[model samples]
Target: MPGARLTHEDRGRIAAWLADGLGYAEIGRRLGRPTSTISREVARNGAPVAYLADDAQQAAGHRARRRKPRPSATTSDGQPTEVVRGFVDEFATLLAATGLPRMTARVFVCLLTADAAGLTAAELVRRLQVSPASVSKSIGYLEAMALAVRQPAPGGRRERYRIDDDVWLRAWQADTGAHREIAVAAQRGIKIFGAGTTAGTRLGRMGQFFARLSEQMGGSTLAEPVGYDALTVLAALVHAGRPLTLDTLATALDWPRDRLTAALDAIQLHPAIADPLVLRTTEPETYTITTRPDRLGPAQRQALEDPGHVR
Candidate 1:
């Protein structure tokens, strides 16, 4: 039984050991399997964070039963043979770290390693030797994540799945809206629970985090400024008693997102003009003016107007 496949119980022990934060060497000592075996098993299943003993064991069995002769795939170094297998294993492992299912990662790697035209479902099924259902499910999941795209086969009705240069970028862009939604929901929750309460306070903090995150997304894309909109926004915030969300500020001031942002940018650049302004407090991402009034001298205060009105 030197090279025998691992038993189900063995896998359970592996999972427990992993949960206990044991390294592969320690787990291998406990399981009496080579360290390489345990490492490869986890890599092909779902890496450490998402690995489930039962699922990994099942996948291992499926792969074992489906094993076939290797193709003429070459390594990145151009050596012929199955050296690309190791790269595929590593790629699948890293993909799982990003929250992709192991099966989905495997299927994605298969397409990535395919010819320029990509592969049909039938081809994926054949290449991975997984069930047609498995290929279909993986394709669907990748499609939903924007990590893969599907198109018609060149001369056939069958659809082909492929990943392109911007697959990851598109996936990141897709989540930017989700970040905006989270910030909005959290901001709304602040008033409902009353910011003085613990729940309201937590919501406010969360609102700030998501708001900053959403605003900083590269895909959010900043806009050019047009007029003295920033001055109006400052006046509105200074007049309002409590902190306000960007959305609320935009509506109350009747300024567009870009203009509001530009105004805030202007105020930030000239803190003396709006030295009392604070973007975050107990309520995150919400804007409020300081309760204490003007520390700025007449000259500094006069300079404030010049910076307050953004170009």
Candidate 2:
């Protein structure tokens, strides 16, 4: 019975046991199921105080229907089913645990597993069985986070939601930037509270941690699998062995001034997380980068190599 699912009758028994003020173990013993199964069911449905037999049964039925294999998603048994549906479902749940909203994670995972052709809003609605508004919310969240990119369909009439091949990289960048922002907030706290106080000490440590992470990630651009345009600018800086002014760097690269500026802005943010890989000073407005990630430990080196390190 450890692997058995609870039936409506079993749910009734649980409700009765709950009414009797019995614990989760006693309820599971009476139902011929493991205590963890009972606990999981109640936790998934609602908290113990508000648990209802009917509600739990209904929720269970709903989940089973959701897990039903569709023609498009065939299981290994050769039955028509949703391929990797359980993986995506469980992955979304895991992301939710990491602070991604349940619906947003579901939407992200949906687009992630969908074909390279991507899915339009209507298609998402039909597949997820959610409303247009829900699709909008989920897509909006992902777009804001730079995880999902929306493109016009071939007909140019509808927009398709797609998780790009660079989704993990973009997600990593965005998550790491969030840490930098958190560190900035901690720095602000230090200013608000006296630096000598306990609160100030905690804030100082918080800022240092995030700043170190940011630095390590920033330096990762030099590691293997580093081909992004921004890193090209850094490579140039490292080769020069001396700080180059923005105007000079732009002139040498034959890149637009705005492009150089944007690249520098992105690079400078890394200093908050760790040692400044790219340093820009107002006194001369020059840029400097020295390749040093090779000297870092394996953990630090891997963090640079992994695009999803922060997330």
Candidate 3:
């Protein structure tokens, strides 16, 4: 009788309790398991329409049998590891507080942790421990909000979904654009509160400033030689001193993989550049300036202007 699982009656009762909108703690009290254990068991096995006790028990057993250890592989004193975890925990909490679905928040958080090189749906399924259906639905939610995107992976049949630098830029710009959209609404608020009054004038000014700033930012994004999104990813990779694959670079740049790949190829074809800058890998190619590159800095700079110039 030891370690006996919940019975059929217990499951139906839990289902009834959930239907009645009882919280997990309340259910735990009734079932004599810890709240988290109850939560996990239900999360692993039960769906909205069905919460069969026998099925849940069997599912839990199967999971325990097959579960793999997900070790925290990042080492201590690794600043990126710490920073990434901070970003993940903070964003996940914020998204939940904002009433976004948990899965949707998770997808966004994944992209953020990657610093704009978003994951593929397959990656999402593996990392988030969610079903394909949930990932699909969550991605749709993200896409509708323009918070996520899909881009091609290098040398691959599968497309990798991503959140580029522009996602945040667009969100900021959208907020700024809203200032112009509902000026009438602001005016109405102004009138109700009295236009000349301090609060109303402040509201009116806010609308004006936002409208102006949005236009400036939008133009800046367009005029910049490199997309701000791409720049950000490059900065992160360089800062981390990590080797970057073409897909990683492409995702970060928000450029097509082929375009960046072609650029790298051009650089390599020029023995001047390739001799100094080493390609890290070829399959999903990456490059980094070798010690040789450091030594050739002056020559490389001159060669930038003169194609034949490599000393």
Candidate 4:
């Protein structure tokens, strides 16, 4: 029932319903159709005030007659048929409606539905019937967003653009990265606008919302919450190249002692960083990063302690 075409009787009922001042939702409810279906029907077949069932039915017939007939057989190289091409265009239009650039959406869809080997720019250009420049620009945009990647075509200078199996995962990660950036920028705005001011309060709420969203989407999957402050502390420690006392870190970072302590605690708790690189507590309450000994074999550790023994 969902995908079934609207019958002539259905169109006549829609016209009568409109005349009776029934909204799309009520009309859809009575007809057991989706609200969007009713809305699109009315929009394309002349709007509510001007809608006539006879005229709308006639237009629908004309449009169907103009549509290309699908072939019963496949092409020589197993390329997409006319019907599949039509579907590609329709799907691309839906993707574009969701904020992706039109050309980019088309290119992305083309790559998505392509063979596992993928498609070269020339192939994409020929398939989409667009200029080389349009294909090139769209591929660049897709690559930048991690939605597509380029692999070398066998025995040729041409590179194939492919939608990886993990493309959606990469895209989700990129979106979460954008959310974190927005949260950070909003936090900065709060500082600039004065914490007690109306603007600052607005920014504070916005910052908190994005921050929570980012943590919910990105942080939960990770070993621990590695936020901006923790990252800043890690960067400072990495740059310092030696152990540093808490007072020294406070002075170098210009952060409150409690804030620095919290960041250090987070860094220590984060297993992703802790495995390859460890957060160490040195003498006199100093902190430093070192290789996690558990990651290395005993011989490897000994070799590092006495490099001459390796030979």
Candidate 5:
């Protein structure tokens, strides 16, 4: 079974079990589920004093809506799989191993799996079936780790939090930064602990290693392609003198169609493209890089490469 569905009736039974002062394991025996599952279910949705069946059902419904899409199963397999939920459960378990609070880990994991591309603090509370205070604390913890970021909602909408492409990269950077700071502190500790002592010698070694690590990371370059790769494609398109179609662009780049589409979308967002390469057709979607160099100036082309200069 993928999982047993908890009905309003089941919630009432759970309440009765609690009233009888039965432990979660005993309750699970009666309910035919794992004790840990029952404990998590009640702890997440039940009230402080009681598990109101109606309220619990409502909360569960909301949570179900927020979950990642489930895969279909058939008689051929003879087993149903809630792969998304399984992955999320494993992710939560991994976070718990890292010493993160279970509730905090679950909340952040939900954000990672959400399909809306982002969520606000309020949405997180609704989706996680958690308290506002709990959601706020979880968000603060994630932000401190640099695992999440806040962004303005599109078209002057509410402030929202999102997991972007740079989210994991920034988190790694923050972790390294912490190590660098600790190294500096260790050096100071060596002086305080007395340079003649064994403890001082160990601390000094730690300081040296981290200082070297920090330097190496600083000098290392990311594998990101320079604007030259993108410019090369644009340069060829300009010389070809015909509106470049999406299919042609994909073939020329020798990359997947989805990747090419993403690139095209990013390029279309560029103000330089908006001014110089007007969309001639969108169905067989084609773009022409205007030959008028004066109109599409070098400054504008450079601006397209710099996101900071997206005026």
Candidate 6:
């Protein structure tokens, strides 16, 4: 009951308390909630003077309904019922939101949720109630992304399209490959624009960001390269200017302990990062950033050793 959502009755009480000129802290104390919770509730529901119990309750109901998925229904023959169709459409809408073509998203969802044997083009057309051309075109798009594949149907000339077990893994790899290509193109732009120009500098940063992103995403097959997460951890340590324990890094980064641990491990192993800046384990689980003593190359070290040295 302590963490349960505030009810309509709670809203009524909040309205009454506000009308009586009660402060958020006082209201929260009476309601057994944190002051911040009470403040946010009141602020979102038109704050103190304008807040109404009935209006707030109705608005909250609408928000809750929108957050939840529609209830699913099934038919006796294992065919999708109207409710199922509606849910599929809703899911397709969400997929379309992520830059996918609407028809392609709809077709992909059908293949993803279909039976193991998969669906023929005619079956897909009937289920989706769309044109054959649309289904064919969408299937083409799905195939290009490695999200779906065509296989020969049993005892028939026609082919069936289905999502494979490794479809999502393949899709992820495809995305990472695309990122690598973009990074390469950006690097080309930097060379063409000349490194000293502002455009080249901007392209260089973009190239590095995409390259790092691609490396992070594709690092499962290769050696784990220093990624965005590891870089972020190093930045946090540098900014802190003091040793920070695992718990402190977790709290500051708002990341899980396991994720932070992985990033810290990556920072320790990356050779490129080992030269100029070292991630030192000062305490058992505490870390600090410090300069590496042998950071300079042989020539640079010699130059530093002898102040008057010249090439």
Q: After superposition, how far is residue 127 of candidate 3 from its true place, in Å?
A: 0.3
lDDT (Cα, tens digit) per residue for candidate 4, span 1-311: 22246778889999999999999988876664557779999999888999999998898899889999976644335754555556666787798789887667878888888889999999887766666877898899999999999999999999999999998888888988898899899989988999899999998888877765765566444534435677777778789999999999999989889988888877665534333677889886799888765457798888878969777
Give stretches of model 5 more than 4 Å off.
1-86, 154-158, 219-311
Q: Give each model's whole-structure lDDT.
A: 0.70, 0.73, 0.61, 0.79, 0.66, 0.80
Better of 1 and 3 by TM-score: 1
Best by lDDT: 6
Candidate 3 wrongly placed segments (more than 4 Å): 1-90, 115-117, 184-311
The TM-score obtained by model 6 is 0.50
Give candidates' CA RMSD values in order.
Answer: 13.0, 11.8, 20.8, 15.8, 20.3, 19.1
Model 5 global lDDT (CA atoms, 0 to 1) = 0.66
**Model 2 TM:** 0.52
Which is better, 1 or 4, measured by lDDT? 4
Give per-residue CA lDDT, model 5, range 1-311, as digits (tens).
Answer: 11336777888888878887888978765553457667887888865266677788899999989999866742222433345445555687688679876656766786787655587777766554456776678778888888877788787677677777778777767766877897899889998998879999889878867765654453232223423344555665777778778778778778677766654554443323333343234346676565334345598878987899996
The total of clashing pairs for model 5 equals 0
1-311 in candidate 3: lDDT tens per residue? 00125555667677788788888888865553346655775777766356666787677577668988664545233545444545654577678678776556766787766634557788766555456776788788888777878878889888778877778877766655565566556767787888789989887776555544544444444423334433344354556576777777777668786666555554443323333234445344655443443345576668876967644
Q: Give each model a TM-score.
A: 0.50, 0.52, 0.39, 0.50, 0.44, 0.50
Worst 10 residues of 4 by lDDT: 218-227
Looking at model 3, the pairs that clash are none
Q: Over the stretch 21-125, how does candidate 1's per-residue lDDT look in tens digits?
A: 999977865553457778887898887988898998788788878998666775334765345545665688788788777667878887788767788898776
lDDT of 4: 0.79
Please give, for residues 58-108, the per-residue lDDT of candidate 6 as tens digits: 998998988968765464456646655666677887987898877677788
Looking at model 5, residue 163 earns an lDDT score of 71
